[model samples]
Target chain A: MAPPEVHHLFHHPIADHSFSADRGTLAVARENNVELYGKTGGKFQLKDELRGHDKTVTGVDIAPNSGKIVTCSQDRNAYVWEPSPQGWKPTLVLLRINRAATCVRWAPSETKFAVGSGARLIPVCYFEEEDNWWVSKHLKKPIRSTITTVAWHPNSVLLAAGSTDGHARVFSSFIKGVDARPEPSPWGERLPFNTVCGEYLNNTAGWVHSVAFSPSGDALAFAAHDSTVTVVYPSAADQPPKAVLSISTQVLPFMSLIWSSESEIIAAGYDCEAYRLQGSEQGWQLAGSLEAAKGRPGLQDQREESALNMFRQMDLKGKSSDDTKLKTVHQNTISTIRSYEESGGVVKKLSTTGVDGRAVIWTL
Target chain B: MAAVNWRTINIDALDPDSPANFDLTSLAPAVAPVSTADVQSLAGHIRQLLRGGDSEGALRGALENPPYGADERGKDVHLATIIEILQSIRQSEMSPILSRIYQSDGGTEALDVLMKYVYKGMGHSSSATATKQITPQATGFSQVHGRGGSEGGGQAMSVLLSWHEKLVEIAGPGCIVRTMSDRRVV
Candidate 1:
């Protein structure tokens, strides 16, 4: 995980966030809107507010290519909003799943996407468009359970979702029709196949708060409320369950998990400090400690006073006043994370929604 | 003579077998061949077998009968009775009698019976008397028996209409059906 070097504080706690695939633009989720930030002058500057969600926005994702943005909200709907030449406009509201989506991810090809929600009745949904209209598939099970997060396998439509019960399920759908006509049920019949990816066992333990699959589909990373982050490799059968690394960080109800560079590094955000894994070790070794937004030494005393005033008033939803009290200590809560692909694992950006009511972007 | 539990039996006895037992072989004459024109008689005969009222005579009649027709409606009734008896055969003390009907009839009757009432029981038609007028026919009977004994004719369509058609083409329609697709000798 990259060290928190530049802590950009937001006014509200960040419900969720995403760094553009090219590292050019960043999007943050808030109560009913998303804020776009531009990376400049060693910090993030608010570019624009993209608003359309009727309720609290829980998750936001940027397409790998077209810069199209898709956001999910507690209102039980996911919408695709594009930054058009005229201005930001809602492109299409993807079919609604029956529950609030905890997380969403775009396929590497950016053609279709998966949405995971809290309702087990329809745990996951896939979206695609044929002819000129958009359509979706609601894949439900005879039995029900809640799904918390979803991640698409790199370069493939394979989807992996983390459930509240601490199980991770993999789903694959095949669409035979090409670009010519509408393909029937892009999310095909659910295959009767899944594996017990991980378990939350101590006391009440914790379910998987976040899940991520490696770029090559060989490895998996899960951050759970069990105060531990588990890394697994599902490619090897016949081998016993392997936990590459475990962390003792106490992630409350919701945690964020992400993969860095080559998937060899795993990054996670908890209530307090965010951590990253650097090797194939059993226990996660802390790479860097998060620091707060500080007034630069080069600035004049008056400027520093003004900067401190801004930082003081800045309240990211997940962090407390004490956590934000000092200019040298990064707030304890982290809502989201993004790894800059081109930057050689140097600055991992941390997006934290603080108690100050802002979406803060930090480079760690 | 001994009480047999049907649920515990191996998958083989779940259907009929060719090697007849003494008890079932003796009642073959009473068993009637399900026909093509009407399934009411065949269903009645199956009713008698289930009642144990005159199963020996019923089995004897079944052996002497020819085969049933493939009219969808009539097959439905015959299938219902076959499935009901097939499932309860072990408990009836008429296992031998039921087994004989299943075997000589080629699993078709047994399968239809299983499909109709046993495997997926009927829930739609609540009134039993509503189905009384249905006549049983032996439309695809020859196709079932033709597999083992070497009968030559066009293959008849099995219950699984689509899959059976493909199988007949693959198995040589002439040696399979005993009748052409139009019911005329080819």
Candidate 2:
């Protein structure tokens, strides 16, 4: 295996990041603006910056087919940026909630998107052809607290959301005109808008941090603050789930996760490393960490302490030096992990951005 | 009748965070109600297990079924028994016992329940110090306080803190977060 490719963009935390379909353009949420970097000369160079948001931009997602970028911010708003010949044009999305938008993701179909917010609601927004503007239908019932993350099913009709109230719910975001009626699945049959197909609470009632649907869309996986990843398989429309496998770990809680395939999930969080979890409806378990455990240089260097090095270190800082850097690739919490490249329902590469301000591309 | 002015209704006044809407207790896992008598019997059994040098069994017994439906006094009695068992175990035995419990069935939940007791014990120890300061006469009747009551209290607190550290090492910081967020009373 080759080492992961690291890109040190800046010293600021990247709340979210997305790569375009062609893998030529990258959009990252930095502070109050979304920076667009284009691949140039075998490197990602600053191509443009979308500067419309007035508050900390929380999320940014690029539609793979349309190349349209959607961004949400703490200022309680979201914007859709369309690439034109001259430049990217911005259009505001009418998310009527009064609280900040926490996350946004373009549906697989690219015709709609869902925005999770600090308010106890999720707004599934789609473009209105007659009105020529993006309008939102709110999913409000049964949500008691702010939503932390939202993921769209493969069919673009079913949506999964994790909330601070400790519930990971699957709801129908089906729009009458925008989305074609999806085939009946275990989630539901009459997929009307705002229909909640399933709701699951973590065993410890820990606040759910991130949620993702399996590639097949038949299973839902969520990472909660309890350092546990729970996988739920729906049995039928309005019945008990077939299985609810909760894989608890003795590590820090996962902040974000992505399904690399139907049976494998890659999660990253405060541990400053990505971990692989593999299992199925029978059971699931933590396989191990993705990063190979390496011997620490600090430990090796401590054994060979020399007088010349000690004096140099003492003269430089007036005290003996200690290793301040972490042993992992990310020095801080990894906030987002996305499938960079996929083929035949299996992810070939993954990209992750973190508070350490480094975007790393890892090939699997 | 005049048309109702819905615009001036102050929708935010109906706060979603109200007690009715945010009833955290409802999220607790449903368990068969345990009475005070049952808790007392279980505590006695746990004490017997501890006497037989089965500390792991004692710990598991204490954590397996917390008195979720019992009164405050009943729960406190059970909590004191658990603290006694926790303090009796040797420091060297702590990690081994925790690892064994962690690997067993429903081990994560057992650890979570133990974390709740650890936090509650810490809270009681701190509050004991506060009451001793505010009302010195309260400790006058107790013979232990006449010599080194505060010292003993401090020692117990240190023990609880060490247990907390060990628990975190085995269960990760998620245990602390779960204990803090859990609304179920032990």
- Who wins the DockQ comparison? 2
lDDT of 1 by residue, A170-282 (tens): 55533334212212222232322232223322211245677777655656667665445566654333344445444433223236666664434444454444455554534
Fraction of native Cα-Cα interface contacts (under 8 Å, chains A and B) also present in model 2: 0.47
The DockQ value obtained for model 2 is: 0.44
TM-score, candidate number 1 = 0.51
Give candidate 2 regions above 4 Å deviation: A295-305, A311-320, B1-11, B15-24, B27-33, B133-147
RMSD after Cα superposition, model 1: 27.1
Shift of residue A108 alpha carbon in model 2, Å? 0.8
Q: Name the weakest run of 10 consecutive residues (lDDT summed) in model 1 chain A.
A: A178-187
Question: For model 1, what is the alpha-carbon lDDT of residue A332?
Answer: 46
